[model samples]
Every structure is written in structure tokens, then in C-alpha cells.
Target: MSVLADFERVDSDSGGAVLRFTGNLSLASLGDLPDRLDRVDGQVARIDLSQVARIDTVGAWVIHRFARDREAAVEGLQPASRHLFDQVVAAEHPIELPPKPESPFVHLLAEIGDAVFTAMHTLYGLLGFMGATVIAFWNVATHPRRFRFHATVHRFEVVGVSALGIIGLMSFLIGVVIAQQGAVQLRQFGAEVYTINLVGRITLRELGVLMTAIMVAGRSGSAFAAQIGTMKLTEEIDAMRTIGVSPMEALVVPRTIAVVTMLPLLGFYSALIGIIGGGLLCWVQLGIPPITFVQRIREVVPLDDLWVGLIKAPVFGAIIAIAGCFQGMQVEGDAEQVGRRTTTAVVQAIFLVIVLDAFFAVFFSQIGWI
Candidate 1:
């Protein structure tokens, strides 16, 4: 067992106080010594370690702290103890507190700036990706044998054929709602017969293509991102490069071409189904026969409206495919990034589609398509 550390204050020959320590000054023997030292009030000229039988790092730290706080000189330490004490003193450093937090208003402004910068960076990257896609398309155009026919056909089924049931159902419901609401408002002014015009024109010129684009953005766009992102995570994309296969030609081009070709057909189909639903609703509520309704639609809805919708469809499809594939190609690091990119693909596609639709609307109106 080690002797407990003890200390006594004495008058020194130099006419000043000295703290004389005794016993083994180790961690186990240091009980109450630190507290006793802290209670010491008088001026301390020196700390005497001559009678200490042994010492450890903990003991050195305690002694060094007391000596430092009192500005007293240490005396009679053995060589090893002196070396340990010197090391303890050398290792001591001031603790750094955390920096103060910024004000909420400043933080909000910083966040807004960061968001704007990120959006600009994303736009630049999307433009670069679109250029790459166009180059890939040119390559395929130059070498027709390089096209992946089976992959593109499969994508056609996935992006177009498989979506028919849900898209048709949604469009039918939208048409019924539009007819019903238009009838209610028109009936107020005895203009209920104009409901046919409302349903036909809106379905063909705006709602039909716009709604189909939104659905495709949510469905096919997200699928492209997830599929490509998974391939990237599994290093299949890298392996394709190793095998001299171009990912852009093999994967991206097929999907892009599939979407670009199928979207117009799907939009037209959606518009036709919506018109049928409106006709059914008109027959049920207003007692208008299907033949009369069809005749009225032919007279009221012009060829210009159908042309407008068709013109927008391919552009919306291209935007959806490009956004999705671009986000997928950007995926790196982990599986979580795949999910984030997939969501971003859908949102980005939808946002761009709406913005372009608005631009198309303005352009068409200015050109007297209305």
C-alpha cells in the first residue's frame, strides 16, 4: 500500500512560506490533497517534494497546477519526477470555446444565398448534360447500327404502354370534373351549352398534355433516375466503360428516344379519353346525346388546339428524360444519394415542364393560336 499524500506549511530560512509534501504522491494517494492545496491562502514561496517517496503523472499534474496558480517555485524533485513535471507543463494548453452563433436574420440570408448559388450550379450542370445528350444523339444518327433497338422498345413499354391505364383514368376523372364545374357556372348565365367548348378546348390545348407530363415526370422520370443511380452504385456504368460500351448510347439514348416518341401519343390518347368522359357526363347531366356532343366538339375545338398540345408534348418529354438521366449520372457515394437524386429528378422535370408550358402558352397566344 502507498502512503497517503500529506503536506504542511512551514517558515523557511528565506523568511517565506514553504509547502512540504510527504508520502507517495500517486493517484491512489492523492485523496483530499488537491482540496487541501486549494484551501491554502497564504503566500507560497516554494513547493518542497524532497520527502515524497514516489510520484506519478496525476501527482505531477496536481503539483504543477498548485505551483502554477501560486506562482511558487518547485524544489527537490528527483530527475524522473522533474522530467514528468516538465512534460505535464509542456502538454498543457488552453481550451477553446465554441464560436458564437449568428443571428437568425443573418442565418436566413446566408441560407438564401446558398440556395441561389446551388440553383445556378444545378442549371449549369443540366445545360452541360443536355449538350452531352445531343452529342450522343448525333453519334447515334451518324451510326444507325449503334442504336439499341430492344432497349428502346422495352423503355417504350415501360414509359408509355404501362402508364396508359392510370393516365386514362386520371384524365377521364379530370374531364368529368371540368365538365361538371363548367356546367354549374355556365348554367347560372343560361350558357350551359358552352360546357362542351370548355371541356374540349381545355382538354386538348392545356390540361391534357400538362397533366400527362406531370404524371410522366412522377413516374418515368423517377424510374430513370433510380435505375441509372442503382447501376452507378453497383459500378455497372463503370464496367460498361471498361468494356468499351457508351452508357449514353446504350442507356440514356434509348430512354430519351422512347419518351420523346411516346409522349405525344400518350397525350393525344389522354385528350381523347378526357373528351369521352366529358361527353358521358354531359349526356348524364344535361341530356345531350353522344352524337350531338361529338358534333359540337368538332365545331367548337379547332385544329390549332390539338397542334398546340402536340407541339408541347415532345418538348415536355425531352425535359423529363434529360432531367432524370442527368440526376442519375450525377449520383455518387451511397444508396441514399440515389433516392435523393430520384426525388430531385421528378421535381426538376415537373418544374421545368410547367415553366415551359407557360412560355408555350404565351408564345402561342402571341402567334394568334387562341
Candidate 2:
């Protein structure tokens, strides 16, 4: 026999309509309940499923939606069938959700505000580090016994002596290029001999210290950040704190002193190397003797140019050290943070060095040094 289902609306003395279903309320027989429920005339206060022989999930859903739509209750179902009915009812009448609109202008403003807040937080942290470094310097100055002589000396050797060969080679190449270009341009004006003046003035006053500072920022600055960041990751910094040692005193102070003390010397060495390269180029390409090139340098290059470059070296060194150490200290205990902060330290130090150079250029011009 085919599966069958039928229902009847019974009027009750209690004054409510009852929907009484019979036979299988399933896909084979009762699939049209949704249409039948739409034509239902009176309010169905209750459903009587006791007479239904079998049912499926579809049948449960139809019955649940009907009862919910008419504000009626279902009864007489076996416990399992009742559970299925409850599930259907709970699912069909879901909780309403609030709307969320995505406005572009609002999102943009939020991003800008977040960026400003982050920048302010970074600035505040940098100021705190600067203050701590100053205090450490003061303490070391007052009680020289607390200073780490060995550490400072080691850092000086690493940052200054070890870097000389590369710095010299780079400055030499730059000097050769500048001299060759100056000779080319000045030859057009028949003033090729003036290449000496051009090379000497530019190298000593600007490119010498500027280029060395940039190289040191990339090399020593990144090294400082990576070393400190690794120490932080391994909890060496925390261990020092536990043992009543300040990381600023032990780690940062030595590095800072090393760079500040050695950078001027390195800058002077680089300037000398660059001048030698320029002189060599002038001798070979411009047909000027080495002695003639040296005489021209002495005649045209002012002592003020040498002083200006030397004056900037210590400042650049301090900036690079501070930026690197500050970024290193900010690293969270992660290897990835170490790499990220090392790159950040180099980039920030180089950028600041360039900006400071620009300011110095303007200052020197105002003071009639240029």
C-alpha cells in the first residue's frame, strides 16, 4: 500500500481548532502540507500527531511551521518525534540579527586615528629611552668604576676598526667617480684642473661623513638591533634585571660610547681615503701630478669643511646607536621580531642621518660656511 496522510480540523468545546493528522506524515504522503497550511481557515490552537503512523524531517518542518504561523502548540507526539518537532520549530524561528553597515569614510577615519595613536605611543617610548640613556651616562660619568671598559673597547674595535676596510673602499670608489665626473663637466668649460677643488670640497664637507654614517647605520646599527633583540628573546635582558643590573648600563651604554668615540676617527679616515682616490684619479685622468692635486686641495679646500664633517660624525653615531638600541629594546620575545626590528633600526637610523645632514647643510649655509 502507498503511504498516506490526512488531517481534520476538529471544533472543541474549549473553543479552539485542533489539527488531527493521521497516517504517515512524510515525503511520500504529506509533502503538500505547506500549501494545505496556507488554506487553513481558523486559528489552530494545538496539533494532535498521535494518530500519525510515521514521519520524516520534512513532515516535522511542515507541522512546526504551521503551528508557529498559527500561534499553536503541538502535542501527542512520541518523545523522539517531539524532539524533532522542537528542533524544527527552533530552527524555523531563528533569532533576528542586527544590521552592520560598512561605510568607507568611517573606515578610513578609523585607520588614520589608529596610525596617529601608534605614532604617539612610539614617540613616548623613544623619549623614555632617551631619558634612561641620559641617566645611565650621568651615573657612569660620576662613578667611573661602574663603566664597562672591556665591553666598550670591544664594541669600539668591532664598530670602528673592523669596518675601516669596507668604508675606505666605498669612499675611494665614490671619490673616483666624483673626480671623473667633475673632470668631464669642467673639461667642457676648459677648467678641468678645478676638478681638484670640486672633489676636495664635496668629499670633506658632505659626502665623506654622510656616506660613512649611512654605511655604519646599515652595518653596525642593524647589528646592534639584532644582538639586543636576540638577548631579549632569550630572556638575557630579564636575567640581567633580576641580577640587579640595568640593561642600559651594561648593553646600551657601551655601544653608545663606542660609536660616539670612534665615528669621528672613522670619518677622518674615510675623508683621507676618499681624497687619496680623488688625487689618484686626477693624476691619471687629468694628467695632473699627485703633488699638484695635493697643492690644489690645500689651496681650495677650507679647514672649515673638514671641521663641519667631523662635527657631524659624533652626532650621527649617537643617533644611530640610540635608534638601534631603542628599536631592539622594543622587540617582543620572538625571532621574527628580531629580524623586523633590525631592519627597522637600519632604515630609521639612515633616514634620520640624512635628515640631520640636510639640517646641518642649511645651518652651515646660514653661518656663511658654504
Instruction: Evaluate all candidate structures by whole-model CA lDDT and list the values in order.
Output: 0.96, 0.90
Those runs of model 1 whose alpha carbons end farther than 4 Å from true positions after fitting are 1-47, 50-62, 66-96
Q: Judged by lDDT against the true structure, how good is candidate 1?
A: 0.96
lDDT of 1 by residue, 1-370 (tens): 8899999999887766999999989999999999999999878999999999999999999999999988999999999888988999999999999989999999999999999999999999999999999999999999999999999999999999999999999999999999999999999999988999999999999999999999999999999999999999999999999999999999999999999999999999999999999999999998889999999999999999999999999999999999999999999999999999999999999999999999999999999999
Q: Compute the lDDT of residue 324 as modeled in candidate 2.
A: 94
Q: Cα RMSD to native, each candidate?
A: 5.1, 4.0
lDDT string for model 2 (218-316, tens) is: 999999999999999999999999998889999999999998888888888888889999889998998999888888899999999999999999999
Provide the clashing-pair count of each candidate structure: 0, 0
